[model samples]
Target: MGETTTGLVPTTVRGEVEGQDLIMWEQLTDAARSGLTNAGFAAPIIDEAFMPNLESARPSF
Candidate 1:
């Protein structure tokens, strides 16, 4: 509880100030997320991503 002109004003950091998960979730929605998190870029983060093995080549006749 904090002081105000007429009463005490209660405030919170969106979900919960102390919880890291909530903070991370909030961060995902924030302005910084425009550059930091890309849902389309997650393909490489997971194992077994599809990519052509450049080393292997067909013998050119």
Candidate 2:
């Protein structure tokens, strides 16, 4: 059987995850981290540059 994959690849002209995408990104990453832990895998090390800014109030989380 083929393997199942779950992931997100955000596309933006400004090269940033904002608005609805930003919220989804946060949720997806959180879920992924939890899932990885439950699966006995090391959590991913996310770079700050790749993450959205929590200070900016563009879209509510």
Candidate 3:
């Protein structure tokens, strides 16, 4: 063993990485939210928006 490294690196470095990951996730989430909204699927009322239309299209006896 020449020089065994030990102990945690640093909280600030780990925090920066976590912050970057959050930023990346936010960007991706925003893009996906926009795509869904454009496609007429509101995030909050997704099922409410499509379920009624689907139900109406079913063969009624």
Candidate 4:
């Protein structure tokens, strides 16, 4: 997801996953980071609020 001063928005990529989604999220996040870096933006501080949710949502093996 991407957020601007106006509001939050979803990315064009969307899907359903059966297991831990961090790998997926990380990939997406990395892409975003790379984009920002390429555009000369500083490294972003991801919102910490999402961490707990991501951890809990991980698929237990």
Candidate 5:
């Protein structure tokens, strides 16, 4: 099964890190993303903190 949750990553993933706000996602600019893709990379690694709602997507135990 599959599901989708939509929101701005920066706002969605914001949290406290060392007592300060932390944004987990570092979305690349279009040029940079294209450059990476052209250079044979799929995409930049995303932090687990930025993972979409897996609890809802996963098959229930």
Candidate 6:
């Protein structure tokens, strides 16, 4: 339902299955072992680092 049938690329991008994005992103980053040291650099390197701001974001509900 989240894909298109007609386009220049002629492709169907299956929509993410529920929370699969978060799960997949986390899975991809699982190889890294983060710690107190260099914590500042760990997140930016991954680019999926939005956890801290997410909690404070305005509640849309």
Residue lDDT tens for model 1, 1-61: 6566654456665866453344564646566676554457533532343333332344557
TM-scores for the candidates: 0.19, 0.20, 0.31, 0.24, 0.23, 0.17
Q: Could you give candidate 6's per-residue lDDT for residues 1-61 as a string of tens digits?
A: 4564442243355763333234443454434444432377433433354665665675978
Error of 5 at 5 (Å): 35
The lDDT-based order of candidates, best leading, equals 3, 4, 2, 1, 5, 6
For model 5, the superposed segments whose C-alpha errors exceed 4 Å read 1-26, 40-61
- Number of the candidate with higher lDDT, 2 or 4: 4
Taking all chains together, the TM-score of candidate 4 against the true structure is: 0.24
lDDT of 2 by residue, 1-61 (tens): 3443545554556847565534444556777767644673333334442255444536766
What lDDT tens digits, residue by residue, belong to model 3 across residues 22-57? 344356677786776668523344656678777877
Residue pairs that clash (backbone atoms under 3 angstroms), model 4? none
Worst 10-residue stretch by lDDT in candidate 5?
A: 4-13
Task: Evaluate all candidate structures by whole-model CA lDDT and list the values in order.
Answer: 0.50, 0.51, 0.57, 0.56, 0.48, 0.46
Error of 3 at 57 (Å): 0.3
Residue range 1-61, candidate 5, lDDT tens digits:
2343442233234465234566433566778766655573333334442355555567877
Off by over 4 Å in 2: 1-28, 40-61
Candidate with better TM-score, 5 vs 6: 5
CA shift at 49, candidate 3, in angstroms?
Answer: 1.3
Instruction: Judging by lDDT, tell me the better candidate of 2 and 5.
Output: 2
Candidate 4's error at 50, in angstroms? 0.6
lDDT, candidate 3, at 51? 84
Candidate 1 clashing pairs? none
